[model samples]
Target: MVTSEWTGPFDPSSDPEELTHLLSVLSSFLSYRRHAHYNGTHVRRQAFYSLPSSHWSLLSRPPFSVLDHLSHLDDLIDQHAELAEAIFRVGFAFLAPKLDSEWIGEVLGGDARVVVGDELKVYEKIMDRLGVKASKNDVDKARSCIHQFYREWSAEGAVERQKCFDPVIRALEEEFASRARCSPNLNLDRSEMSVLAPGAGLGRLVFDICRAGFTVEGNEISYHELMASSLVLNHTKTAGQYTIAPFALNGSNHLTREDQFRTYQVPDIHPATELASHTLNSRVPAEERMSMATGDFCVLYSQEDSKETFDAVTTVFFIDTAPNMIRYIEAVRNCLKPGGLWINLGPLLWHHAAKPPPSEEDKNKDKEDRTTDANERDIGIADPGSVELTNEEVVALVQHLGFAMEKHETGTFETGYISDPSSMLQSTYRPSFWIARKK
Candidate 1:
């Protein structure tokens, strides 16, 4: 099981917490996110590992939910580890800006040395630093990232991300080559292309791009994610080296695969190893090729020399998180070079879409406050679905903004909340993607 201390970022737009206890709670959350000693054994709840799904339909049709494999406690560890890591990273992104490298290394890098009122101490320190209070609702709203952890930032879900960009990468190469043909002086192979992936969660796509031999910068606004990612990247020298993070599922009993009835440790995660193969190819190792910056996507490059020079600007499941999707689109367009690629893959769930207008027929009836207490109403929170556009509508907007649509696709991608092959918490999104060039 993962320690809930780390793995969430701060986003106050949706009212996660009130102002009063926010910093204290944040400190408490960060304290727990760090690893601690339990009964003299070191537990690494920070590192995320994927758990295998255990389904019983292995003997049945193509959509077998059961695993035909054997068992180990590793399966349970993986799913839980993944969730733990996500939460931990969220805190990492939050704390990164407040603490410098050495201080962070000291806090997040230690064993469970002192456990006395650690949360309180952390909270007081945070309150002192922030000079403000953090309410529970605002904190709760920020906590929503947990529900999205697996979908946007897990290895199992990575293939879906690949689907979004592989086509664009191919197009980029073709476009560059075509341009070179027009001007003999233009050298296609002389320089590496640069890409900017804003709000890059956990940097998996950033790594994938580096492996493909591009210079990439992954930008994040959250200190939690930035710190967590930095920690993961710094500690993981070899692929699968940090194997302590394990996983298991909740309902393995339903699986028909006799062996899967027991928990099984999934395969190893080789993030660092993936970079190893590409390291030798260039003077800059693959790991070095992938850079990260902590700041807002809109203003981070607004005054810098970095804008208008990137060969590509890629966003995956990112724009939907924006307070205003238009701002993100405008930012993307401004930063990319002329003829550069703007590759976007995500749903149109607009974070700032107002609730649907009340109908005249229902005007007389006062709508109930859905967040009423448990005694007054059912103990369920309202879904914060965004007011997003249809894929078609979004593409039209891009075209109007001077982008030439080169490719588009609509398909379904399933993302698992837990790695349990048998659990039913996973979800599928019917989303659209576009690969357009600035005309």
Candidate 2:
């Protein structure tokens, strides 16, 4: 715990110009995903000449504006310790000078003369109310979530995500159907199958299953994503009103048609629409069918009522997020009832230790779970200390846990998110389904 008087080696004094530049850059970055406009464009691009506590409400318009519509500011800031911690850490980063210079440059427009905020003293003073001493790693973790949060839970992002994940979802549903047939209690409510998705970032998949007529509960650890997902899933009365995305689309040739600023409106992801979809269980609203549990995946399901086990477990783009794959598989196995289905979809690459990282740009380009120093961690090895098992190895390990393969496929899919229909990520991963009965 850093005391109030504690100080780090970093200098505190920053140029007024740098502070102004930082404020404008962060404000503009926040604006892009909003419905408002800066100079009549989706994003406010002008630099801020000065920023004082008085202008905060106007500043709040672009950044904290959407948070209000989602999670009321009083509740989010005052109640949730995790969100407050994230804000404090990232807030420090935003104001601190030249920390993670390369990444900050990328986010702040990379102008050589632009001074990056590094004033720890100012940051501490500004962030004193939320007095948590967040380290560099903490700042990186928080920044990644707050910065790119829009892409996962936003209206436009959901539509694109559903399309890209069609295969994985199909596999899970098919296996679920088969399992339902074999169960003695086929008479059970079709939506009552106990489904668990660990590392369920933003609860999109959890709600997706609920819509498909399954009783689902998602587990998420990242407080940042949890805060956003909880508000969107449980609190928001209307969807598409919130903005969860858009930092940059300029100069990227992915746009099919030219616009005033080389940008296209990202598709709207309607969370409400997802709930009311005719295909979803019309009998129960999504909120009634699903819930979110916040905790680490590795230990989340272990302490449940010893008799309680899931009918199926779905992990999409999830398994790889862990430092070690074995613990995740073991945890899934522990949570399963006899002959329960386990569906997995995500790249085999370990979150921290993939060797040489497909490419430098590839690593940084797709910054889903990668830390700021992810590239530096890959010290020129064909394989790093982290587990880099092949899809086949993963399956074999699960089979060793007494699971039998039901269906599987490997392929690459381009999923679009982050504010434009054409803007997408081309990621390759294997999708697998297996029925396991405890031996």
Candidate 3:
């Protein structure tokens, strides 16, 4: 169950570095309105300034029609700006009230005064309280996270979710169906089946599994995703209550201005309403049916107590994020019971494949660099410990680690990750989809 205000999954005050990072993340959401407007208007207007004064006269005419194009672009940018503002408001609504004066003072340093005159009063107030600035990269990541909402919660994302999630859901149902056939009188209880989804970003897959009549837990490492997912899963009261312009910031490859400025209502269905029915036939309490865990997947689940803890494990576009793919396979193997299914759908797009080796200096960094080092490891950035493997080798390693391949399909389904359908440039992945059972 969700509280009136989410304090977050862990106590930020426990670790000074982590507390600072959390405050930065919260500040990013508050700062996003200014960043979005600046990027949309000021930065883009510079393009027009680049052309010569006389050249504008010729370009503004019929064939080129620079003036008309500029007008249309301005409208699109405005539309996007509005959407960015909405995202910021939603983020603030979930996070801001949790801040107390003591927590705010830590981030404020000495002077508590923040330069005034932000458009949104609430936005300015939080900015003043935190008195910390989000890095450019962190703010950019916060913007990218908005696009993820369209992929995971909006109706526009349903097709992509169907392609990526359907097979895994089916595999779980089929596994239990087979068991049910053997015992006609005592059919397998799906309520007893517990599934784990590591790297469960935004939690749509985990919610889908719960809707499919099984108890499931989603484990996430990214704070951005956790914040976004928590808002949708816990605070949301109805379908289409929240609206966001996903394509507002992304301007290139747009077939039309309308396409670039497209908006969508999030959580096509109410999360709680859809899953509330799952409790009627189950022994688990309504709250226990669905849960989210925050932390590193390997560290949290790759222990002796976690061994054989879940009836199934599901990974969607997840495994390749590992520095060593073997550790991911080992973790999955460790968590599942004997004969438990490990359903996976993803390409081996190794996140750290292109990263060069770390410098000798980095290998022997001082104590002050510990915070930076720990942050790098949290995001799965390539380190001296990182390794990359081929698709064939990954399947082989899963088998070697006590899992038997029951189904394997390569290049069968072409999937898109947070893709804008109307955009001219489409990046699609023909992911490796498979189901393997623990021996």
Candidate 4:
């Protein structure tokens, strides 16, 4: 059973009531993560409300019950106007300033009035935006624009968003603090290698590592995410040098935006004093210190010619999204030098498949199951379990690719369903954390 442990920025002991409230909020947040559209204004109104109560009964249970609840909810969400509105509201709240006004207008305009043909057109556009190539006459077509937007937005930042992850950060700090005391060996200082975080959404983990004195170079795939990470990093660096001032005569919080301004502190490179000094004085701005590349990971990896070049490579929730997992993995392996490290933190259990059939058994099964299981399989092609490697498989693959296994650990973030008892679909698949060294 998951335990409730307080270890974040907020002082739990100072106010028991506030702690309870925080826990409740965290639980609600996790529920949203599991079935982001469930009970949403749009979903409840359009379709979920009409679903038989029997369909949602499994939500009260465990294991695959969340799936059952969502399956039932999907039917109601497909039909009811109220449910659709609820979904829209939930999605809007999550997306906030990022929700495109034009998209919202189109969704509201098409509500209940969209023709099958129009829906198909909108669906195709949405799929294209998601990098999904849809074939004509495919029954497992793209979801509506509204659905696609919500899913993408939710996946991008909901859990990783700074505000939502405050507790999670605290929990990790506490865990590390305890481990540092018990396992002295784990207390090694940051290595000389620089970490390249591609698609570094919000940079929460990156910031943490930097605070621990590691040099991190982050490249966000989106502008919004890059801006957010910059803002947060600036705040963190400033906070380190200043203290909160007590309210003056006006009784307003004395902290002002001006008080927060300070020269941003970039990571100090050890042993490379000349290079470090040059990096600091270089014309490239601190925000742009790490060159941000916007494009697909496979393309980015392919452009590089060196094998065993970097000291370390980090990817979070990235491998599962790769169109070609083997190619991606091979590229990553090539990028690392002998003794270089590759650290990945994400759910390895991809919901979709990544490659094509490779064996006789798979070929026979693919033919038989293609019709019924198409949607359940990989979105691109039927890869015979060789493309998307499982966590164990990944470890083995890395070893086979000439990497020495250093460490592997699994831990749940507080933002996940494991901490939220009310969540219907708590992820059963554990997020794997791997640390491997190139041989």
Best by TM-score: 3
TM-scores for candidates 1 onward, in order: 0.59, 0.56, 0.83, 0.40
Q: Comparing 1 and 4 by lDDT, which wins?
A: 1
Write the residue-wise lDDT of candidate 4 on 1-439 in tens digits: 0101111222332456433332332222222322334333345444544667776555435653544444544443343222222332332233234436686456546456445566433433332333322222111111122122221222223343332334333433443455457678754333333455555654544544344333555544332343333333432232222111111101123243222111111221111222234443323322333333333454445444445556567776666665456665676777666666676767765645644546887677766766678544332313434445667877777788777876676665433321212223343445676667667
* Model 1 CA deviation exceeding 4 Å by range: 1-155, 176-191, 241-273, 279-284, 302-306, 355-387, 412-421
Q: What lDDT does each candidate get? A: 0.52, 0.50, 0.74, 0.42
Rank ordering of all candidates by TM-score, starting from the highest? 3, 1, 2, 4
Better of 2 and 4 by lDDT: 2
Off by over 4 Å in 2: 1-127, 133-143, 146-151, 154-160, 179-186, 244-285, 304-308, 354-385, 412-439
Residue lDDT tens for model 3, 171-251: 888877887787879855777789998888888998888778788888887777777777778877789876677776666
What's the ranking of the predictions by lDDT, best on top?
3, 1, 2, 4
For residues 1-439, what per-residue lDDT tens digits would candidate 1 score against the true structure? 1112222232332243332333434443343323112201122122211222232233223444222221233343344344444444444345446456575345534435435557444434434455554344433333333323343345544555556656556655666577668877754541267888887765556656776667778887654455445544544443333322212222334444433233322212455665566664345556546777756676555444556868888887777676545556677788888988988776666655675555655443323533344433211112222356766777888888878998887875543333444443445556676789988
Off by over 4 Å in 4: 1-192, 219-291, 305-309, 354-386, 410-425
lDDT of model 1, residue 240: 32
lDDT of 1 at 393: 70
User: Which run of 10 residues does model 1 get worst, by summed lDDT?
Assistant: 39-48
Tell how far residue 335 is off in model 4, in angstroms.
2.3
Candidate achieving higher TM-score, 2 or 4: 2
- Cα lDDT, model 4, residue 386: 43
Model 4: weakest 10-residue lDDT segment is 242-251
